[model samples]
Target: MSDRTQEMEEQVAYLHKTVEELSDVIAKQDMELRALTQRVDLLIRREADRQSEAPGAAIFGDERPPHY
Candidate 1:
C-alpha cells in the first residue's frame, strides 16, 4: 500500500480504539449512576417510612432543634 493509504488506515484504527475506550468509560459511568439512583430512592423511602411510623417523635427537616 502507498504510504498515504497506510497512514490513513493507522489513523482510522487509532480512532476506533479511542472510541471503544470512551464507550467503556461511558458504560461504567452509566452503571454507577444507576446504582446511585437506586440507593437514593431506597433512602428516601426508608426515611419516609420512619417518619410515618413515628409522626411526633421525628423532627421535621425544616423545623429548628429544641435547643434553638
Candidate 2:
C-alpha cells in the first residue's frame, strides 16, 4: 500500500477512537443529569409538603416578613 493510503487509514482509526470516547463521556453525563433531576424533584415535593402542612410557615423558625 502507498504511504498516503496508510496515513489516511491511521487518521480514520484515530477519529473513530475519539468518537467512541466522546460517546461514553456523554452517556455518563446524561445519567448524572437524570439522577440530579430526580433529586431536585424530590426536594421540591418535600418542601411543598412541609409548606402545606403549615400555612404561612417561617423558613427560619418564626422569622416573619420584614413588613410584619
Candidate 3:
C-alpha cells in the first residue's frame, strides 16, 4: 500500500476511538442528572405535605411575646 493510504487509515481509526470514549462519558453524566432530579422532586413533595399538616406552625416557631 502507498504511504498516503496508510496514513489516512491510521487517522480514521484514531477518530473512531475518540468518539466512542466521548459517548460513554455523556451517558454517565445523563444518568447522574436524572438521579439528582428525582431527589429534588421528593424533597419538594415532603415540604408541601409538612406545610399542609402544620398550618401556621412554621410561622410561629418556638418564640414568645415580651409578656411570656
- What's the alpha carbon RMSD for model 1? 3.2
List clash counts for every candidate, in order: 0, 0, 0
Angstrom error at residue 20, model 1: 0.7
Q: What is the C-alpha RMSD of each candidate to the true structure, in Å?
A: 3.2, 4.6, 7.1
Question: Cα lDDT of model 3 overall?
Answer: 0.85
Q: By descending TM-score, how would the candidates be arranged?
A: 2, 1, 3
lDDT leaderboard ranking? 1, 2, 3
State the weakest 10-residue window (summed lDDT) of model 3: 55-64
What tens digits encode model 1's per-residue C-alpha lDDT throughout 8-54?
Answer: 99999999999999999999999999999999999988987888899
Of 1 and 3, the candidate ahead on TM-score is 1
Worst 10 residues of 2 by lDDT: 55-64
Instruction: Give the alpha-carbon lDDT of every model.
Output: 0.91, 0.89, 0.85
1-68 per-residue lDDT for model 2 (tens digits)? 99999999999999999999999999999999999999999998897778778867656534677788
Which candidate has the highest lDDT of all?
1
For model 3 the TM-score comes to 0.72
Instruction: Give the Å shift of residue 36 in candidate 3.
Output: 0.8
Each model's TM-score?
0.78, 0.79, 0.72
